[model samples]
Structures are given as C-alpha cells and as structure tokens.
Target: MPSSHTSSTSRAPWRRHPRATVLGTLAAVVSALALVLALPGATSAAPSSPQAPQPNPPQPVKPGEAWMGAGVQMHEGDSTDGSVPDEGRRNLVASVHGVDVSSHQGNVSWSTLWNSGVRFAYVKATEATSYKNPYFTQQYNGSYNVGMIRGAYHFAVPSSSSGAAQARYFANNGGGWSKDGKTLPGVLDIEYNPYGSTCYGKSNSAMVSWVRDFVNTYKSLTGRDTVIYTTTNWWKQCTGNSGAFGSSNPLWIARYASSVGELPAGWGFHTFWQYTSSGPTVGDHNLFNGSMDRLKVLANGG
Candidate 1:
C-alpha cells in the first residue's frame, strides 16, 4: 500500500536491477562451469556419451604365479600341463581328481568344478606371515558350499620369521581346521623360496628345524598335522632330504609328471599330488590319491 517511490527505494538489489543481477548470475554460472571443466578427470570436449570415460586405475600386484606347482616350474624346471599326465595319471595311480587355488583366481566358480568331478580342493590362505589371500573366504567357503572337501594352505616364508610364528599367523588368519568332515587339515606349502635363494640361506639342519617348528605349532593349534606341500627336489635341497615329517604329516607332492615319481625321504607315498598347473578347470589340478571315502577319512581326522 506504500507509494511507488517508497516501494522502489525498499526494493532488493536484484529487484532494483534485474538485468544486471541476471548478468552476474550468468557470469557466476559460466565461471563455475569453466572451473569444473578445467579440473582433472573432466574435459572441455564435446559430450561423447552419457558419462566420461574413467581412467584405468592402477592395479596392485596379484598373487597369481606363486601357488602350488610354482616351485617346480621356477626352480627345478618342470611342468605337466597339456601333457596328458603320462597319458593321464588317473590311468596310472591316482583316481580322485582335485584342485588347489589362490586369490590369483578370484571368486572361483566352485559349483562348476564340483559338477566336473573335482571332489576336493586346497585354497591358499596365507603367504609368509604378512599376506592373507584376499579372496580366501570366497574360494574356501565356496568350495565347501558346493560339496567339495576343501582345505587351506599356508605358503611358508621361513626367513621372514620363525616357523612357529608363521604357523601361528597362518592359523590365526585362515588356516584353522576342524573335524567337520568337510575341512582338511591345513597344509604347509614349503617349497622353493620364491623370494630368494632356494633354501632361504639356512643350513640344511636349520631348515629342518624350521619346518619342525612350523609343523609342531600348527599341530598344537589345530590338533592336526599339517599336510606338507613340496617337491622332492626342494625337500632334498632345503631340508637336506630330511625324512622327519614323512610319518607325521601327509605329503602333498608337487610333481607335474605322469606318475608321482620319487617322494621326499620320509613319505612312502604322496597323499595328494599336484599333477598339473593348468587343469581342465579354473585352478591347478591334483589327485587325492584315494577314493572319496578315503578323502572323507582324512577330513574327519583319520
């Protein structure tokens, strides 16, 4: 109801000069748009699609080439892939087909492996004391859920820490075992030192002692002797062909040959043989060296 002069005087800055205010607002909007286009990961180019192409992020080093038969391939110069396993060892000694996997093969399709006659699997759980396979839960539990008897293995790094300490780390992380008829005893993958000299620069007797400590500690923690995974050549080179663990721990021999040739001194025969790096399925293929009943017996702490 005020006079026009009084109303004009009381008008806000924008209302008094709407054209100038609109120009200022448009300038601010253009400046902001310019700033956004100037920033990294955004460009001033014409719109190519609904979204800009994101740059490929850097990938962390994956544990792809360091599991199971890696030592035989690295140190001893042996491989059994694509070679029919001496015309296939299923015809020679082992019957039950199995597999071993690591985080290298992420999120395994275990149901596919199970339906394809793989009755057992070993998943790498820990490396040294520091690394735990990031895909451990999926690989381990997935294999079990699909009715495959699965176990966990620790890749040993003796020089980094004591055997007992590494064993503890392994157990505390993912290498635990129970008599649930589905979980096999944890395995100690003590093969060639992938980091350095083959024997970890330890004397033969010292190497033997290190393995003994790891085995003892794992047994104390899980009430099960760990399955020892190694090549006959590596066992001889590192432990001086020590036959100490043969009787107590089951052997998971890594030999990519038609037959599981010579075993380490202690083990009369291998319970599990990693026969090929490339199997018919996703991971390394192995043989359980027995029937399904025998595999269950091992799982049940037999």
Candidate 2:
C-alpha cells in the first residue's frame, strides 16, 4: 500500500492519454502513471487494409532499430497478420500458460491476445488495505470492449497491523469483488518484499493469518472464494499450503519458467497458471499475462 507507483520518467509510452485513464482502483491508476509511458506519437498511421502496401523482404534488424509511429514499439514476428507461431516463441511449461500483469506493462489489444491464444488474466486491482492500482484502467474501461474475461487480484499485506482491516480495505476499494462469475475471482498476492516487511511479515503464522483473514472476509462479502498468489518457496516457508477457505478458493501458482515443461511437481490445486513473461499484443503495448483459451474457460465458470 505504500506507494507502489514508480517514477513517471521510467514508464512505457502507451499510458498517458484520456483513453488510458479509465482505470478502477487507485493502485491501478497510480501504476498507470509510473508503469506505462506515453509515446509522443504512438497513434497508428498505417493505411487501413486496401491502402496498406505489399509485404517487403526480411530486413536484418540492426541493434537499436526503433519503430516509426507513436506508441509503435516492439515488432510482431513474420506473418504480418500479427500471429506468433509456436516455432518462433520459447516453449512454455505445461501448467503455467497465463500471465500476471501490473501497470508497468502497457496497453493490451484484445484482438492480439485473443488471436495468439491467451487463456486468462489476473489484473491487479487493490493492494493491502490502502493502495489502489491504476494499471487496469484501460482494460476495465475499454480493452474488453473487444470481449475478454478478466478477474481481479488484491496485493495481500497479511502482515498489516490488522488482517481484517486490510481485507476490508481491498473489498471497499472496488465496491466489493466482481461477482460476474465469468471473471476469475479475487487473488491474494503474498510475496516477500524487503520494504514490505509489514505487509507480509517475516514469520509463517503471521503470513498465514494474513492470507486466511483476507480470503475469509472477501469470500463472505463477495459470495465468491478468493485465490492465493504465491511462489513455490513462499508456499513452503510462509504459506505452508495449509489449504484455502474451501474448494472454491483455488491457488494461482506463479513459477517462472523457460517453458511450462520445466515446472516441478506437486503444490496443490492450481486453478490457473502463469507460464510466460511476454506474449502477444494488440497495439504497441506488450500484453503481460496468459492465454485467451484459458481465460474463456475461467470465464465460463470452469
């Protein structure tokens, strides 16, 4: 909750616009200011379909080659259609197929994520009891205008002075969790932070109490179970995989991998898995999270 916002000068260029300002939680909003930057002229200039030019031969991209238009950042792979075939991308772990995004990553066009095969997304909303995130503004406001099922997650500060207080802070921020039953439910991010010692605490009981309290209160209030976000090490040392409030409250396991095949065995019931760091995108902004196929399943109440 203590100013997760980064300095504006360091952000990506896709964020600074009236259109990008449509975020929900304050944490998300602040993230927008810090995480994503606005390119001076990121707007699209390519001629629509018929007006576009024919394909050109492969040009070796020299070091530091930059794109031309505003907001025009990274380039798509071959197949000007914007699709990333399995051959070009790094292979992924089997379980981890989703992506976890903070405001730092810029605008995600639904079409790009959809076309490339994103399953689900856990958009950061509230953090601890006080910080509100601004990263979700675009997605909450309009990116879904193209239709993608999304869920919300609260950065858990179980080590807060009052665990219940932190839970209420998160619940109150978004007028309670989204009960659409289509979007993924709330998630409690229980990570270690050298500066966030108070948020997560240094002991196991404290962390467990913090996670349980938040999950319990959120479920009671929203009529939906809350998920836990943690790494394998944190699970063993801090959380202990003691089990959630019930079967409804699943685990969103985050384990970075060169490929999903690299993930180790046996943690607990994983409702969704985050497999990659960078995936496809609609505009210049890089989509930070997982696939659309998984997203639809979670959306369909699977």
Candidate 3:
C-alpha cells in the first residue's frame, strides 16, 4: 500500500545500467546541442566582418589661406602692408620653418635671424641654480627689436629647492622673464644630461615635481602659465603620468630630427617645435630654442 515502484538501488536492470544509460543520453543531448550551435544564429541577416577604414580625401585651402604641411595651416588676415619687414610680411609660402636659440651658442646677430626667414624664437633665460646666462642681455632685447616674436626658458631645479625660492631666483635674477605679471611666460627645461649632474636627480618623477613647482610658482608671480620643455624621453618619464598641467602651457618640444613627424605620440598639443640646431647661430655659439610662424597664436593667446 505504501508504493508500487521500488528505488533504483533495488531494481537490478535500472540500477546496474543507469550510469551507462544516463551517460548515453547526455552524449546524445550534447551532440544535438553541438549540431544546433554549428548552424547560423537566429539573426543570420547580420553583415560580415567590418570593412576597412576609408582613406580621407585631400582638400585645397581657401584663398589667402596656406597649408604649412604636417597638418599646420594659417590664414593671414587682411591688413595693411606694415613695418613687420618685407620678408616676415611675405606669404607663408612654405612650411613653418623654425630654429631654437640659446645665448650659450647662438652667434648670429638678431638681424641675421630676421633675414633668414625664421619666424618665432625661444631664448633660454636661466639654468640650474648658480648657473645663469651672461649673453641673454643682448639676445633678449635683440629679438624684441628685430620684430621676431620671442619667449624665455629656464633651466628648472628640483622641487626640493623650495618652489617659491626657485621661481623667485630666476624671476628676480635678470632671467629676462616678465616680472610685472606680464610678457611671455617662462619654460622649464627638463632632460637628461649625459655628463652633468643636477639637484633634480636623474629620476623622471623628481623632474615632474620640479616642473610643477617651478611652473606653479612662476604663475603665482607672473599671473601667467609657464611652459615645460623636453622630449619624448622626459614626457614618457614624467609628464605622461602626472597629468597635472594642461597641454595649452606652450610645450617647447626638443625634437631635432628630419621632421616634426618624428616626435612621439600621446601628447595632446604642442605649441613649439625645436626643429633644427644648424640654423643661424646667435653669436658663434650653440643656443637652445626654436621658431614657428604659428607661434603668433600662442603670443596672441589663441
């Protein structure tokens, strides 16, 4: 009266062969599932794999606009034929040709730089503590009078120098950067010295902190952003990680190669490109900066 069916353990045929039968059933189900999966999906209308990206078509520049190649172009607005020199005033018939200069090695007179068809100039103003330029006096004022747009650079010290003190030393010590909260901002030069030593040490982290300290302090004093100059090495080692400063801080990248295309990627914006070391020297010496026609945009706060 309790139950008619017995447990599989009590049934000889079912219990002894249960394992094999269950295994066979599972195999059949798996094979059926495999066959179903092998067929196309229910939504078989989907297209095939992605098509290759289409190449961008070339386009011509509008009248009065010029292509400087390497993705730089410019438009010289309508203006009177002024006293900006016949050469500087000429149309941008070529790419943005430029060269960096330092008071240390540039030997050409300002007029020579102006006549050489160069555009903008960045002059190194200061070096690490206790090392300052002796020739910047003439170079700074020369670039101004020659109508060549100019900027200043500083040899940055480690943040361990006390941020405000480091900035003050360069700002007050005839570094030629603007002191009255106006004029072009400063540049913090951060790179490895093959045979030299620095308070910032050889670590890229130290260099990043030093750059931030120097730039912040300079801005505190001058009410303007300071530029940071370096190359692919320093960027990878330092700025790429910190992510504090904006790309708009007028980056002066030192890439002395065949072209600006050789510069590394991931840097969002580059304001200045130090393209050559063999251009007109300031005074028979190797200077340390560059020139760019589009630098006028930086000057005009573009």
Candidate 4:
C-alpha cells in the first residue's frame, strides 16, 4: 500500500508596512467587539444549561479516492458502505474484471472468485533473487483450474540484485509462460520500494537500465514480453519517464482514483488497470483494458 501522507505549509501574514498591520488588527478588534455586543445577555440568569456539542463538518470527498486502513488501501467504491454499482462494474472504463494476489491474501477461494466475476489473476511469484510466495503453486494453479486466466509477477528489488538475476529466478520459479491460451504473460511489479529509499537510491538512468534488464531476461526465457506493473508516480520518479519498454511490454497501471489520470511516457494506453487493493474480491481489483477476446489474444502470446 502506498503512503498517503500530505503536507501543508502556512505562510506568515505579509506586512510590508507596519502601519498597515496595526490598521488590520484594529479592524479585526472592532469586528470582534461588534459581534460580542450583538449577542443577547443570558435571560433570567438561572442555572445555565449545558450546550449540545456541535457536529463535525463533513470531510470533502474525492472521486475514486481510497482510504488507508487495516494494512490495505481501499477505494471509496470498494468500501463496505460504498460499493461499485452493478452498472458501474459491468460498464467500467475498462471492461474485463480481474484480481491480483499474493501470500498476503492467504489461501484464496478461486472458485468463489470466478463465481464473483474474476476473469483473470496475477499471483506474486518471486521478489528479487529470493522470497518466493509460499502459496504460489496453489494460487496459480487454483485460478487456472477455476477457468480464470492466470499469470505470475515478480516484486522488483532493483537495489539489492541485478534485474537479470532476479528475472531468471522468477522465471524459473513461476514467471515462465507457455503457448497455452489460459496463461497470461509474466509481470514485473515495480513500484515504491517496500524496503528503503523510494527509488532504491539509484539514479533515474540506472533504474531504467535495471527495468530493461529484467524485461529482457524474462523475455529471453519465456519468448513473450513481460507485463510491466507500475504507478504513474513511480514511473516518473524512478525511470525518468522513460518509455523504452512501452512498445514491447504491456502495462499494468495502479491508480485508485476514479479517473486513470496521466500515464507514464511511452505507452499511449494501459492494458491492465488495478483500481483498488481492498475490493470485494480477495485481492487487488483490476480491469483488463479490453474484451474477453482481446484478453484471450494476450494470453495466447499475441
């Protein structure tokens, strides 16, 4: 989950001339005195009754905004009191519904998920040169058995390991692809680093090189382009808005807002949109950018 910390700065009142400041203070005092005098005196002066507490003002709502809680960020539409309407779900900006999961979701009920209208799934396969999801086998195979298109993703650790090494490890473990129409291409989950610095303390060019290495290695192993999963902020900050992989790799964008907003450089459109992390489904809610037929073509290595 991404941190939603926001900071605000207050500027000191400008007083180029001291006389202006004194005049402003005098005016404020006069207004305060007038307001005080306008209020009526307490009638009869009996035992004063306690005043009722005023209700707090409603907070402003942002369309497609998400609240962070319970170690996950839940979109407003996916909240318990605010579900995406059936019409909205059926007619989402992106048509096909899906989900992405990891060991964090524990043992998932793939059948229940399929029944709930999940057409595809991306399961976490590996992180860096180590850390394979313990439940990868069950989650990967289970989704496929339940008739959902399945794919695997690697959590990128550009700071600690060479991208090629990590890619090789991921492919060997679960990121490999086949001509089978049910399997989607492997994904590279590269976003905010969960470890240390946001950019993994690397220069923008280094980050781009790292990503290219990962994609190249994965492609060599699978004979299919790796899907690049990222957020707009991360793409700009870490990769310097490079679109080197845009032509070859499909994009899986994460945005919890109502609108997709501006995408990274290179890609004119996104293939996958992860709209919410805590949805009715047991993982991140997503949408394939097209119809089932297009998704099928992608799965078939088109």
Candidate 5:
C-alpha cells in the first residue's frame, strides 16, 4: 500500500501553494459584493425629512344637509319658500353673474368658468372651528388667479364652537379680506343647521347675539364687514327676522326664486342674491346687484 502511487492528497494544488486558498476565498466574496451593488433595489441617496401634517377636513354634509341653494333645495321640500328660481329668471346682462362652490365640487375648471361669464366666486373656507375645506387652496386661489373677484365663506356650526372662536379660525385659515381690487370681503354663511334643529336650538335673541359676535370678531380681524348668507324663511323662524345686522354686515340672501323676495328684517335691500343652485353651468349661480364698476368698488372696500 505504501508504494501504490503518488498520494492524491499530497498532489493537491492548494497544498502546494497555501496562499491560493485565501486569495480564492477573497475573490468569491468580492464577486458577491459586486452583484449586490448591481441590484435594482440599491440606492445611495440621503434620507428625507418628515412632511408637515395637514388640517382635517369636515364631515360630508349629510342627506338633509347642504350648502348654498343645495341646502335650500332640501329645505324647500318641507319648508315654504314658494317657487324656486330657474335659468329662465336669470337676466345676465343687468347683473354680475357669480357662483359659490364647496368641497362637494373638487378641482373646478376656473378657465372654463371664466369663459362662461362668471365674474365672481365665493369658496367655502371653513366649517366652525373644527374643519377647513380640503380644497381651499385650489378653489380659492384658482378663482382669483383666473381674474374672478373671489372671496372665502365660513359655514356656521353654532353649537360646536362659539362665534368668536369660529370667526378667528375662519380668518386664520382662509376667510380673510384685502382691499385688493380682486378680493371680495369675506362671507359669514349663517344658515340652517344641517346637523340638528333648524335654529341650532337657540332662542331668537341668542341666535342674533351669535351672529353679532361672529361678524364683530370677523371685522376685528379682517377690517371689513362680512356678507351674511342665509334664507329669508330661516331668518324669520329662527331670529324672528331680527334687523340687527342690516346696517353693518351686507346681506347675501339665498332666494332661489324669480325675485330676491322679502329680506330678513332691517336690510332695506339685499346686496348679493344667490338665484339658483343647479344652474346651466358648473356652480351655483348668483347676481351681484350692481354694475362692474360697483363690484370693483366693493372689492376695493368702498
């Protein structure tokens, strides 16, 4: 057995050169490293910073709830506001045609609206102190950028927060006014409470006081009186048709009818009239009861 042949273990190449085993191992390791670096999932970029949190959006208006004439449309079925206005009543030449939009409509076409003869717009900015329209920047800035006299409005939720608190929230968020010729004064949309009882369970005096507090606070912050948007019938039933706000705040009467109809209490005439919700165009239609020069004057804080 000792003389059989050259032993196979003694004839091994690595055994003859011990460094070749270590070099071969290192070469295999380097090949694997190159493969990992070549993979599609690999990256050499730096880490990113965290993004800021966005404000929460409000709950969707419920089945019986709405904004502008849409609210009135629902209210008219059970309530009395005889004869809703249609496109037949719209005399566009005599009055400024405008529209009001909320989150229900997302990412509107401002250019198309401009070409359609819409000269002004009111965008829903906030709902009480708890919510802001998620589409505010797009709706608010989009309208203004397109050469429309644009303003922001706050939906009243009297029960959830005080008037002062809500007003502050509105101003800090989007309901602000400037003397710029294109920006209309901010609006206070005090209308029927979609969440509960029509009057928000407030007595006539209490509701009136709430409205007063809101407009006062809003004025203190924005240096301009707010336009009050509401229905005549709701005002009659809830505030007992109080004429307290007539002298200061402009009335934005929501009457979906042939005429602007009887105003609330003290106001001798309505300033802005929302004539129709479902219109021939994209948004709710309105009439600014003045000429273009007068509308510009109002925007300039005349």
Candidate 6:
C-alpha cells in the first residue's frame, strides 16, 4: 500500500512512558539519599569515597545479521520485482529477509526470487469484500513451490464493508492457515485508506471495533491470530492508540527509512518489518525479526 509519510527512526523493543521515566529518576535519588543516611556518622558535607565501578548497561540484542547495502547480491534480469537496486537494502536492521507482492507486480519469478536469497513471501489475496487479486493463486502457490514460507494478506476497507464480512471473504478465498509448517498466519493490511478519507471516515472507536471484529472472526475460522500490517501514524490516527490487538496479534510494520521508528500501541516488538517498498525482489521488502529457527516456530503456529 502507498504511504503518505517518508522517514522513520529505528525503534527500541520497549517504549517507556514519560511518566515512568520521571518516577524511576525520583526513586533512584531517594534510594541514594537513604543509603548515605544509613552510614555511620555520614553527613551531606562528608568527603565522598571513590565511587564503585558500575557495570555497563546491557545493549539491546540486535538481529543476527547486520544491515548491508542492496548490491551485495544482484541478478542480471530486469527489476521485475520492483526492487530498488543498490538502494532498498541499505540500513537494514533486521536478521532474515523476504518479499511481499500483489497483482501490481504482474507475474513474479518465484524461483529467481528464492535464488536471490529470499526466504518467505506474503501475497495479497483480497481487498475489502469484493476485490480479489487476479494473480493470487499463481503467486501464493509459486512461492510455496519454490520452497519459501508463504502467507496471504487482506487489504481492509472498513467503511465500505463490515469487518466480519471481509474476514470471511479473505479466509474463504486464500487467507486461511494450515499447520503444514509452510503457511504463515493471514495478514490484515490496515493502513492509509487509499480511497477517500485516511481513516475511511470512521471514528477511532469505530475503527478499533471494526478491527476487533475482523480479527476475532478470523481467529474463530482459522484458529490463528492474524498479523497486522500497519504504520505507526496510521495506527495512532485511526485506532486512537488502542492496545487491544497488541497481546494477541503479530505486527508487520511499514516504514521506508533508515530505522523502524516508534511502533503502534500494544506491540513491544514487531515480528516482521516492511522496511522498503522498492526492494530488489518484488512488491515490498521485509525482514523477519529473528533467526530461521524462530521463523520456523512461527510457520508451525507456535
């Protein structure tokens, strides 16, 4: 989906609330004063002893692989994948790499994609209630045939159709998941409306209710939580910072910058990050947030 924003910063695993930071600072000060008071004959004017060596704070564990430039590996064919050669791959901050596609990409060569080190794919299946991608079957099956983890996504249109109706349509068509250890859970693409108003003219509460309806219905049918594909701005503007889905749904964040940026409410970390739309493969380029083992666990419905 086309996004309105451009730049974003890499996000930390946890977003500390401003109130929490203030309280933590005050507690530290109070604890230091109490320690001094407990010492024998200690006074505020007493000479300070050499401070104990403080251990370095632990660094956030990054993905297994570091970000590399796009041209690290290249193929001789035309950029049929919408991949932005020598550009999209830079500043990558994730471990595993993959691609997502739709009819807009035309016919993709899945084998070629796999040969280029693509490990997974998310093919667009349906949009709203009536529109289904014409090339969904070939794209979805072709990725699987090429031995890549595969999944399907639905583009949401909450104003035009009810969430339950769209979820049923998506599941029945191609978004359903199987425990075969190859298929990933379905994705709900809920971002810029792409039609009229940004939020499809729905209030934040209504939008949140619609999303809940969609995910709940999808879970009832497939027995798996749907992955949510969204940008931080859209989530905040449309959903009013709701954390309802954070505990249950996995996040697939979209940001076309050097960093992942602050995420929506609820999610501490994103499972998949759609870093760039103009990747060297097809459609959007993404990273699985962990190692191949974790990817397998996700595929196996863990």
Give the best candidate by TM-score.
1
Q: Which stretches of model 1 miss by more than 4 angstroms?
A: 1-65, 87-94, 279-282
- Model 2 gets an lDDT of 0.41
Better candidate by lDDT, 2 or 4: 4
| Candidate 6 per-residue C-alpha lDDT over 19-46 given as tens digits, one digit per residue, 9 for 90 to 100 | 4553454344233322321232221122
Clashing pairs in 5: 85-256, 85-257, 243-266
Off by over 4 Å in 3: 1-96, 159-163, 174-183, 194-204, 238-240, 261-266, 278-294, 300-302
Give one digit per residue, the lDDT tens place, for model 4 in 1-302: 00111011111222433645534443443333223212212111212331111122113212111111111231123332223334224334335667676654445666655655567888878777767766677778988999989999887778888999999999999999988899998988887754457788999999999998999988889898888888887789888999787778888877765655788998877788776554312345566766676788789877
TM-score result, candidate 6: 0.69
- Where is the poorest 10-residue window by lDDT in model 2? 64-73
Better of 2 and 3 by TM-score: 2
* Residue 199, model 2: Cα distance from true site in angstroms: 8.5
Estimate candidate 1's alpha-carbon lDDT, on a 0 to 1 scale. Answer: 0.67
Worst 10 residues of 5 by lDDT: 1-10
lDDT of 5: 0.67
lDDT, candidates in the order shown: 0.67, 0.41, 0.42, 0.64, 0.67, 0.64
Better of 4 and 5 by lDDT: 5
In candidate 2, which residue ranges exceed 4 Å CA deviation?
1-97, 175-181, 194-199, 244-248, 258-267, 278-302
- Residue lDDT tens for model 2, 133-186: 544565443334545456666665454446577667766765254535446566
In candidate 6, the residue pairs with backbone N, CA or C atoms under 3 Å apart (3 or more residues apart, or in different chains) clash, namely 9-261, 10-259, 10-260, 83-279, 83-280, 84-279
Q: Residue 246 in model 1: shift from native, Å? A: 1.2
TM-score of every model?
0.75, 0.56, 0.55, 0.71, 0.74, 0.69
Ranking according to TM-score, highest score first = 1, 5, 4, 6, 2, 3
lDDT of 3 by residue, 1-302 (tens): 01111111221232334555544443343333223212222212322331111122123322111111111111111122111222221212222333334432323255544554444455556555554554455556666777766666665545336555667777765543443222355666655332224223535556566666777778777666666665664466544445556443555555444333433343454555543232122111111222232344345433
Sorting all predicted structures by lDDT, with the top scorer first, yields 1, 5, 6, 4, 3, 2
Highest lDDT against the true fold, candidate: 1
